[model samples]
Target: MENSKSWVIDPLHSEVLFKIKHLAISTVTGSFRKFDGTIITEKSDFNNAKVSFSIDVKSIDTNQSQRDEHLQNDDFFSSDLYPKINFESTSFTNVSGKNYKMSGNLTMKGVTKNVELDVEYGGSEYSAQGQLKHGFEITGIIDRKQFGVAWNIPIRSGILGLGEDIKLIANIQVSELA
Candidate 1:
């Protein structure tokens, strides 16, 4: 893999967030407390970069301790059995400007499904420490039931307690791995 240079994800400089509609009136935003990722690219523009990412289900936090515990149970992530959620890139399609579409397989709760992530190249810069750094913003949407986390509540208002589709967003920063 000499042609490809691997970049390590700077977890401290990155963010993994998700949002879903709650009660059909409000939106709930949450973030994973633990995750890691890496990018491998041979070209400087990252047109064909290979991406891999993982998020710890046990680290999911939605503010309320009760809610967090519930998410970690069988109703949702089931962190005890499948503690990690992973994504591996299959292809990258560049659109106009810095926009791109990344197709990959996302595995969650022991189930894997194809997903497409919207990626935006944020350019690159040299850190004060003289390390080469790259930035990217990625977003995607997925159905909770598709991953075997099909827990829903029907309300009297003819609405579900939570939305089926979850929006995922990530602001990633990486440094060239020496």
Candidate 2:
């Protein structure tokens, strides 16, 4: 962790997405429209990294206004009270070529849990602007109820409600800061 430098997320080229099974036959997908993260590392391989990010919960978008609004309310994320979702890396371990195991603390609605992310490093490159950049596709799954978003309503179809599991993904592109 010596001589570490910070690399910032390029918001224009990065995204955070989540999907959950709705009614057992359908999927509800959403994205956090606003987020930012930084990685502090001393090596190009990123094996030893400190990463963190904050996502604006109110920016959750599923392309449906009504559903999106409900997600930001008390029964769900309760964005008015806890407006930010956060993550801080605990460890980043390389599994092989492009594969990695990323463990971190993920918090939502004031509930925090330890989660592991599967990351695929897409390598690094020099951009058209001549900046060193790194790319990654990260994925993880967590139980929504564990995060205090435990809203369940049964439907006539006997579908119960939304599924307990939530799958998350992040396609990130970051540039080194000199």
Candidate 3:
């Protein structure tokens, strides 16, 4: 870890959002209000960077207090038991110009799975405060059941209360540590 440049997520400039199909006809959006992440790299381009991220499960917000409460229950996140969702990157590699592939182990509800996400590097620049910052957009799809979030109520044949596939989108801004 010595000699490596360190960067921490700027919560004010970052957002984590997720979307899932509800009733097979509509999409429900939710976000985690609290998260923390860090990246360590020796090069400015960020290839081979080490990445770690965590989100507070209880912070799930769906714009509805009722639904948010349900999400924190055993049927969904079970936030009381597993309070945090974490990801540790195993590899970060450039796929093409400004695009990269990040593979990591995602742990949720005590289940861990290896997942791959597409990363778009938005380039690095100096912020107004004279801090070096890097921007990245990460997108991916994951099956909730794989993470022990398999709660679903079937409305009818070929229809369910919620979708199994969840889309994850994160607009992350990281500021370099001085």
Candidate 4:
């Protein structure tokens, strides 16, 4: 049976941020403005909860119009061809201490790869608006090359314009649906 305590993602209160190495020294951070997700709590155990999310590729933002436009081009995300990045949870395993491992299939740039996220639950409580809210913070890393984002321009001093690894961090706020 499905869990009774279900939570709908509050997009207004949630964010999906990513950071990538620039020139092997500095970091470039950006986020997707249009994304949504959901979390379903299991009555038997909260650890058995299920989660899923989707991000719109066109929503990529880096505070610079030109950079953002370049990211959505064919050399990078190719937003016109691959309109979305999706994740579906395959398994949730409790590790030692307060850590948990969430394995899921991440689909991006027409490629699907299995990725593991280190999840930390921030507990649940009732909000002022008379809604039950659950907080979670998840972090993960993905190789940009694995998702077909291997475009790079080599510069002097062994530096490249874009890095191969991308770091993802998500701060999610889920509200129970009545």
Clashing pairs in 3: none
Pairs in steric clash, model 1: none
- Candidate 4, residues 1-178, lDDT tens digits: the string is 8646777889988899999988788999999999988767677445767778999999999999999999999999999999999998888777865578999899999999999999887777888878878777889999989999999999777788788889999988889777
Best by TM-score: 3
* Weakest 10 consecutive residues of candidate 1 by summed lDDT: 40-49
Give TM-scores for every candidate, taking all chains together and pairing residue i with residue i: 0.96, 0.95, 0.97, 0.93
Report the C-alpha lDDT of model 1 over 1-178, residue by residue, as the tens digit.
3477899999989999999999999999999989998888887677778989999998898898899999999888889999999999998778878999999999999999999999998989999999989888999999989989889999867789999999999999999889
Clashes of 3: 0
Q: Give per-residue CA lDDT, model 2, range 1-178, as digits (tens).
A: 5677799999998999999998888988999999999999877579968999999998999999999999888989989999999999999999998999999999999999999999999989899999999999999889999998899888767676799999999999999876
Q: Which ten residues in a row have the lowest lDDT in candidate 3?
A: 1-10
* C-alpha local distance difference test of each model: 0.91, 0.92, 0.95, 0.87
* Candidate 2: residue 32 Cα off by (Å): 0.5
Highest lDDT scorer: 3
lDDT comparing candidate 1 with the true structure: 0.91
- By TM-score, the candidates rank as 3, 1, 2, 4
Which ranges of candidate 2 are over 4 A from the true structure? 156-158
Q: Which ranges in model 1 have alpha carbons more than 4 Å from their true place? A: none
Candidate 4 runs further than 4 Å off: none
Relative to the true structure, candidate 2 reaches a TM of 0.95
Between prediction 1 and prediction 4, the one with superior TM-score is 1
